[model samples]
Target chain A: MQVNGVEIEDTFAEAFRMVGSRILITACSRQWALQAATTMTGFATSVIGCGCEAGLEREVEPEETPDGRPGTSVLLFAMSKKSLADQLIKRIGQCVMTSPTSACYNFLESSETVLVGGKLRYFGDGYQISKLLGGRRFWRIPVMEGEFLIEESFGVQEAVGGGNFLILGQDLESTLRATERAVAEIGKVRGVITPFPGGIVRSGSKVSSKYKFLRASSNTPYCPTIRSLVDSQLSEAVNCVLEIVIDGLEKTEVGEAMRVGIRAACLPGIVRISAGNYGGALGQYHFYLRDILGGTLG
Target chain B: MDKVILRLKERSNIPVEAEAICPDLFLTKSQQEIEELALYYGNKGRRLGDFFQVQGERSDNIVIEGEIPNFKKIGQGMSRGNIHIQGDVGMHLGALMKGGRILVEGNVSDWLGAEMEGGSIRVKGNAGHLVGAAYRGSSRGMRGGEIIVEGDGGSEVGELMRRGLIVIGGRAGDFVGAFLIAGTIVVLGPVGLRPGAGMKRGTIVAFQEPDLLPTFHYNCLCQLSFLRIYLHHLREEDLNIPQEYLGGFYKRYNGDTLELGKGEILVWAGQVA
Candidate 1:
């Protein structure tokens, strides 16, 4: 498939299942709310090193929040249920609680299972108070700026992660340029997460086995496009392929992001592009690149 | 006071025990059942059906024509209902309601809204002491709910409240919100001496004047930006406050120094800081 004169490789992007939670952090102003949310979701790009994946889903107006204050909804994802609670407790207790005139609430799932505020209430010692309004429980912890109101708990549900597509280019600069455009376009996709730092991964990995403890290693098969007698997956003009993995609400959302990202990457100097999946062996969710960009999915 | 017309064609006032009457009860019940229930007055072991006359079965509302000064614990423990009393009622009105609303058209006795967990109560006239106060030996007061009084009230209003809100439009007697743990209470009229006497947490906003207790120390006077935000929020609600008070400054008093020092009394003193 050729999109805007760029060849679409007949490959598929792989994805796996993960748990996600959405939290709404509202403050006295939009700036303050953004400050608190940004701080809370900081250093949380990928589960590889950060133990979780978190991002600011959207900035909300006063009417959009439960307390009618300017707020931002942030989505936090983790590989396990325990880490989801662990990551939330640590970040919220540090970021939102420390921020002045700011508050946090449940933005996505509405239930009692995920304990965010309930865990942070310990900051108030025994003096911490709980108020149930219209059936939703809010913890009122006395802070320097009067009180901080946070929902007792957030709701958690199943989500998808590791959905990816690689953009192969001629050189390093060309690879970076095309990947940058793809990232910018794919960033507009909703209900999905790009957990990697800045939503772009430079060092893409391959499945296992240089060491006993190593689960995966770098992909060494597609190295360069130089004229040489070497076993490589690149043509004479092909040099590098940057990957854009997505984690969204559904497999279709991730597939849609791939379509937009690929369409945006079909520019000058970019050669044949493809995706790195487990060859139908690894991740449960499979988004065939050709099928997705060609507007078809099996 | 102007008489509030009560039609009782629907909903059974089946011995509605809380002190006041609210209209929401009539939405679901048949009128015949209410007339039979309103006459109920449970004393000692006697059933509440012994008090008033069973009138026409027309509306969920039951209007009492004469004074009902001896009724105690009216509309108690009601979950989804409304009651409208025409005359002065006895003590402990809306004692432990979980849901629904109660509106009293006349005066009421002591212990209004004591131990109320949920729902709302609005009294149009004067009430005796301990409105929204804790029961005899218990420390937990109204955990969640709202209480509004249009006229003067007796002492100990919101006495050991853990959560919920209480709004008094008229003067409140001494010791308002004595030991509030959490929640908010806004009084538009004069709050007599010793408000927030032993409060550990929660907020009290008096619109007129507050006779704060000596235990409450005057905190750093700053233009409370959050108050403007909170006031703006309240303004959007169906709150009954004058425009002058909404824009006024509140003397922020942080204490019940005697406790965890978490309680606050924001008196609307008509100044910016």
Candidate 2:
């Protein structure tokens, strides 16, 4: 299948099951809210190296937030529930709690919960105050700026991670531009995050590496410089490739993000759009490229 | 959604115990069976049909109309369903209620939501003393739920409350939130003498400056984000919340140092910060 002039590969993107959580941070101003969100989600690009994957999901208006302040919503993904909980506790305690005039609230309400403020209340050193309002408990810890209010617990649920699509172009600049457009479009989708820096990954990985210590290596087949030496998957016309990786709260959101991103990436100078998969051998979720382009995946 | 209406027929001054007339208890019973149920008229045990005119089939929705200043324990210990009181009610109006809702269109006497565990009570008019307060011997009062009083409140409101919220749209009398363990009480009007006295851990937010006791020490002034969240919740409940209050700063006072000293009183500073 083809969209706008770009060929759509028939392969699917394999995504692993992950545990995810959404956090809402509200502050005295929009600038501070964005600051805390950016800091909390920083350095969280890939689970392989960053311990977790996280990104800013969206900016929230005052009326939409629990504390009636300008807020930002962030999504974080981890391979296991325990790790996700640990990451949330550590990141929130260090990043959000330390920010000025900021408060944290759980963006989702689920039966499965992790202790966010419940465990961080120890920072108060016996001076914390707990208030129960509308059936949700919130802890108020005194800080230099005043006090920080945070919900006692955060809800977590199973999610899909590593939903990606590759943008192949005739040159480096064209491929980078297409990837940038795809990332801009994906940012509009809620409940999904493009975890890589600037929402684009240049070093797309293969399943394993020759070094026994490494679990993944660069995708040699798609590397233009090494294409002639390796079993190349790229055509002679394709010179550069950039991948957009996505993780979301659900498979439907991830699929929708892929669909939106792929459509946006199919611009001028883009040769083809393909996805990475382990030949259906590892991951449980499969996002077929044709199904996404044909509007069949929901 | 069957509604059972009970209108006062007798004009006796003696208070009647209508604890057993709750929606959960009357939902499954026939109207005749409900009327025949035993209730206390002052010190004497009498059938409910003897004092009130019972109408409609029994259901989870109950309506009590007429001048009922003598009706006590109107929805005591009720776990679920809805209750509507059209006029003034006596004491213990919704004591120990766990779930569901109660709407009072008129004034309510003392002990409005004493020891309530869950559910909500909305009073359209003034409420007497001890709203959401613990009983004389109980350790905790109004463990969960909410109480919204659209009119004035009497003294010692929210006394020893453990958890929950009480929002008063009108002035509240003296000793509001006294001995409060943990909870939130927001008064949108002027608060009477010595509010938040002896409160161990709780919050008292007043629109007008309250008469603070000597135990409360003045703290720094700042905007409280939690109040905005709480006001938003009240707005969702259809309360007429003042927009200016949502963005204003408040003068914080930490005390009842005589007790645990964790409680705080926030007086609206009128957009000062």
> Which prediction has the highest TM-score against the true structure?
2
TM agreement with the true structure for every prediction: 0.79, 0.98
lDDT of each: 0.74, 0.91
Error of 1 at A16 (Å): 1.7
- Ten-residue stretch with the least lDDT total in model 1 chain B: B1-10
Q: What is the per-residue lDDT of model 2 for residues B1-273, given as tens digits with 9 covering 90 to 100? A: 568988878666888888987878898899899989888988899998998799987588888878788889989999999999888888999899999899999999999999999999999999999999999988888899999999999999999999999999899999999898988999988899989888998899988888789999989888877888898999898889888888888899989999999999998898767
Interface RMSD, model 1, angstroms: 5.0
- Give the local distance difference test score of model 1: 0.74
True-vs-predicted CA distance for residue B119, candidate 1, Å: 2.3
- Per-residue error at A106 for model 1, in Å? 2.1
